[model samples]
Target: MEVEKARVLIVGAGGVGIMAAYALEVGGKAAVTLVMRSNYRRAQDAGISIDSVDHGKGIREWRPTEIRNTIPDVSQEGIPPFDFILVTTKNIPDVPPTVADLVAPAVSPGHTAIVLSQNGLNIERPLLARFPQNPILSSVSMISTTETSPAVVVHDFADAQKIGPFVPQPAAEAAARRYVAVYNGSGRLADVVYDADVPRARWHKLVYNASFNPVAAALRMDTARMRMSRHVVDDLVRPIMLEVVAAARAAGHVLPPDLPDALIRVDPVEAAFRPSMCQDADKGNLMEIETIVGEPLREGEARGVPMPTLRTVYGILKGLQLQTKVAKGLWEPAFDDDNPYR
Candidate 1:
């Protein structure tokens, strides 16, 4: 008898999600299904095309074992439960249909592991609160892929990921190990690794996400343009990164003191790469300001650590979000007669 393959469902079909599905398919260890929201029609009709550096250039018109548009469709009666449900969507809790709601139906208590492959800090809180009995695997990815258009992906660089149990319970740890094995069984396309301390890993990634990501959006510049200016590095980027280190230390996740400098040294100085938030702002989409900046800032303040740089950037990004809302006609500005400026 043929052994049964592990079933996996990916919630977001962006560049990261597509690459993840590709990795799983290449391994042939599991049956992969992708939930495409924005490009469902295109993906269902034309399939996904990948221009990859790691998987080579011949991955045109690729589809996972299943293509789904909603979680409910996959959670229907008689279908086998997913062994893993990876949420690769951008972490914008401010938006409707919280990630908790989006992935709740497919969760199989004590069976399915919830994997988060997105950015930001404290992103697993809601999932933990909702599924106290299930395992929540937090991950930090180092892939460089982009969705230039609908159903099209450009995989330029590394496809690595480090995942760990969020709650660290026995069940959660086992889930993390299993996921690492499944993800890397096909020669480690995602280069999966297990991290015992995912929180510390989150803080390390935030040193860049909290600093360069927001700054890129606020300044309307890419990574190369921002790195071009010595003043920007010395004044804004370095300061914010240092503040993040301090904040992380205050939150009991002490990162390496040289982390900021090391990250700067390895940053692609010449690539005109746009971080996720920069791309969101350019498209007038909601950014993960609260999770990336607000949550850490609050964590610091609760511990009496001052984060003026983060606070200032948070305020600016909030204003930018408001601008986006107004442009989309989802929000209206109000004038108060008591205020002279109004």
Candidate 2:
């Protein structure tokens, strides 16, 4: 009897990362290691859970290991390099910046394929120059999920799909074996397509993210409200979709001719879902504006396409950041002793 031959490293131990780990680990077919920030101690107590379409496909308990901490810099003491790497970090640019500095020293292009389970547009093109030889892939999800607590999550919605560049001619054999290796052994993933229209697949997700995220965060509203309101749909939502479509077109993305129709598809009354931007804002963390809305709008303007709606939303989000800052008081405190941000 032969065992599956692959070593795996997951860059995040957040909800998505741990879910994938459980999928891989229960199959008992792959070696899995998760790299997360030290703050994941919070996750340990939170009680996270995931349910798949198939029975016996849920992670009951997760005792995750921290890949590295105490030193923001990479250390050579432990952690063997792996054959496959899954980057499940936030879509913010800082994540990739940090990953490059931390993981690159231990990882090499040889036998390493990375799957970027991130959101936003144009994330792939930026990494090409440095990891030119490594097979880089992208994935998106329609399900609304959250890292409820380190230990548990209530998966409100569950739609997991992955699509990537057709594992180039050179690494086709290795990549496919590894792709099949995960789902075939684990039974946690499906609808994994490796072919053309991948960019379209990516942009399709961008449309969904942009439509719900900014509106929800800016209005401090939830998915259900935005989906239910005509004011949000006509005034705020549709315009943002237009800007997103413009940006996608400017970037040479292929989309249906009825781009607006494709971009703005929300349930008549939004599902019991919370947008990531809303979640991030509620947590008082840095939101993914720069990549999701800000960057695409800028890209469109740079390419002579107009994204007024996007620009407006970017401005509003920035103002909200300022309001948050003021409330938190990074400035000289009016009340020096107990400044909120302090």
Q: In candidate 2, where is summed lDDT lowest over 10 consecutive residues?
A: 65-74
Instruction: Kindly list the per-residue Cα lDDT of model 1 for residues 1-342, writing each as its tens digit.
Output: 766778999999999999999988887788898899889999999889998887888688899999988785445655778899998988888767899998888988768899999777788899999988789998899888988899899999878888999887889999899888888767846467999899888888999999988988898788777777877778788889988899889878978878888876666766787778999999888888989988888887788887888889899999998898789887789887787886
lDDT of 2 at 301: 88
Candidate 2 colliding pairs: 43-150, 46-149, 47-151, 47-152, 48-151, 48-152, 48-153, 49-153, 328-341
Residue 319 C-alpha lDDT in model 2:
71
The list of candidate 1 runs beyond 4 A from truth reads 73-77, 335-342
Per-residue lDDT of model 2, residues 125-150, tens digit only = 65555677777666664544456554
**What's the TM-score of each model vs. the native?**
0.93, 0.79
Evaluate all candidate structures by whole-model CA lDDT and list the values in order.
0.86, 0.63
Report how far off residue 162 is in candidate 1 (Å).
0.9
